[model samples]
Target: MSEQAKENPILEVESVHVAYGRVQAVRDVSFSVPEGGLIALVGANGAGKSSVLAAVSGLVRPGSGRIRLEGKDITRWPAHKRVGAGLVLVPEGRQILGTLTVAENLRLGAHRRRRQAAPESEMYELFPVLAERRALPASALSGGEQQMLAIARAMIARPRVVLLDEPSMGLAPKMVDEVFAVIERIRASGVTVVLVEQNARRALRAADTGHVLETGAIAHSGPAAHLLKDPRVVKAYLGVE
Candidate 1:
């Protein structure tokens, strides 16, 4: 990471508003994901968490305000173009290609994108299970394995920032834990992550900074550890005793 990349955020959404026709989904929302760390957005259902991801990755256009990547405004950028610019999204569902084998999916992720000069031995190193199942058709894998493949496919693209939407959804408790462990490893490997999750407890635990969304706006944000300990956060989301 350059000095600018280190000091400057990888992605910044400033005072953005997005709507579906006239039904506003996000209103004047703003947040920043620092380069090379995990920043999570946590909220109740329909709090506009997914909309935020859509706006950032250019799936939805913002009515007002700007989206910046590395200090450059990219609100006008298109989705596929954003992928070339090093922004990628692992959407809510594990959208793996069922007919493709694991290795094929990974190779396709790197399609039209430059491979990392130094191989990501770390990825296979991190998830030894993926290597073991590399030849299986995606549909043959378990739910947890499919989720892992989705994340691994994204990683192979070598994106500078990734937007992850509801990664823990539909996962059993054990699978959820395993998926989160992979997310932590992704952050550790120098990729900035923007995580949108309804599982506030685990999201806050894994994030460096956390944003709490309510009804399409950023209701609260701060350091993860501090927010994790906040009384209101504990009561509403953490279920502290």
Candidate 2:
């Protein structure tokens, strides 16, 4: 590990195990994100990608092991507390309130720390279509627009680390490209990102490092560029010849 990594890990998951009743969803999964780095967690459905994000965001408790943010233990923190502490999760499926106007839904994201929220102008700049539809109900937005809104809402909270789950799911190919571009911009803006996606090729391309999870355990972990070219990764996840 580099000295810079040691000095500034924005998030750390150490031997995390997560479960629901008798069923375990994640087993001994571990990774770390350096400040301002983008880490991609890629796997098929039921590989426990979302479970890890849920645990990091405090939406679910780990049965064992520790979760730390900037080196402080946050394993027992509540979801709202985690958000306030600069860890936010943009869950799969743009869960914007259907009845609320786009602006209203976005304001709700800042409920934890209104004073620290990013300005609406910043979000508008990222997704210009959103600015034009700010007054419309969130349900009225197209699939890609709703996804953009979900990302914008998370950004409004000014989180230090964003756990993004399946941002490209259910989008057209063009929309997926657009979303990936926005994700790149998000990383450029200096926020650490942990992206969980089944879109392995795109996710690995966008990330600084990549981890491959299989059946709740980390199967492979390394630099994103190397993973992209790895024969096993390309054959199993990237669908390359």
Candidate 3:
């Protein structure tokens, strides 16, 4: 960890375990994100990457371990409470309302704190295409456009830490590039980011730090640049050259 990171992390996931019914999806996963840092969590399917994000967003309760934000423990905080505390998740599949207009979907994201919500203009600036289709149903937008809306909606909450799950899933190569660019801009704007991505190469390239999850457990972790060059990581996750 760097001197700046040691000062105080923005988000901490400590030995968390998440289970559903008879199945344990995540086992003793732990990682930390420093303020304004971008941390990439990369793994194959069923590696429990999304489960960790769900636990952090309060969508799923951890069977054990702790989650903290800004030095305070938030392990038991409800989803709404966590959102109010500046933790937000832009879930996979761009879960924007299909029937609602683009503007309506963005408004819903800030419904919890309407008075303090970021102005729509800010969202528009980040995603100008959304501005052009404000009155159209969210379903009408292209895959990339809907992804942009999902991110814009989350941004309206003014999150201090954003958990982004599979932001590049099912998009064209060009669209994927656009999404990664936006993520970079988001990080540059000072929001700590925990990105769970299947694109290990891109994720590692973009992240300040990288963590690899295998079968719900952390298999490796270190500086993103180092992970990108690691022989084991490259062969197992980043693809053989």
Candidate 4:
């Protein structure tokens, strides 16, 4: 990684609060993802983990505080504009186009300016299975492949930071491993990842840092290694016996 990249964070959420109607979803959440690290957000459902991701991706507006990309305030930016600013979200449910061919879906991911031959080659490198199944309709692929394609499509946009929500949800054990491997590779390639996972133990293991959310607020935040060894974290989230 470049020295400059290591010196600056790609995304920063500072004291953000978000609400839906009368219910507050995120309360004063603050965290930073460095340019090339996997940062995990772990919590039970309705703990505001997804809320934070939505707020970062512009799907949900923060009622207070600021979001910065490369140190620029982007709290008020819309979703499409956030993508243009090199922030992308691979939303939950692997929202692939079921009727579209794998190649077609990937093509849709690129902006008009970035629809070059090089992106296809890059994606093929990141996901060889995608190259093999490029002609198949997205619906025909296995669950893991669909998730891989969803991630590869996001990467095709050349985003600096990618927000992944519940990436391991509803997948088989082997498939979960495959998905986490892909996440590690993305971070190795210098893309900052803000990952939310219901599988708290696995999430903390895969991330460089982990944050625990409870009732719309961050209850704890620290290095993943340290958090893994923490008794409270293990007892509460990891189900320690």
Q: Candidates' TM-scores?
A: 0.92, 0.97, 0.97, 0.94
Please give the CA lDDT of all the candidate structures: 0.86, 0.92, 0.93, 0.89
Candidate 2, residues 113-224, lDDT tens digits: the string is: 6878988888898889999999999999999999999999999999999999999999999999999999999999898999999989889989989999999999999999
Candidate 1's TM-score reads: 0.92
In candidate 2, list every pair of residues with a backbone clash: none
Summed backbone clashes in each candidate are 0, 0, 0, 0
lDDT by residue for model 3 (1-241), tens: 4687757898999999999988989999988889999999999999999999999999999999999999889999999999998999999998999899999999998885676689988999998899999999999999999999999999998899999999999999999999999999999999899999999999999999999999999999999999999999999998864
Pick by TM-score: 3 or 4, better one: 3
Q: What are the per-residue Cα lDDT tens digits for candidate 4 across 135-154?
A: 99999999889999999889
Candidate with top lDDT is: 3
Q: Which ten residues in a row have the lowest lDDT in candidate 2?
A: 1-10
lDDT of 1 at 215: 89
Span of 10 residues, lowest total lDDT, candidate 1: 112-121
RMSD of each: 2.2, 1.5, 1.4, 1.9
Candidate 4, pairs of clashing residues: none
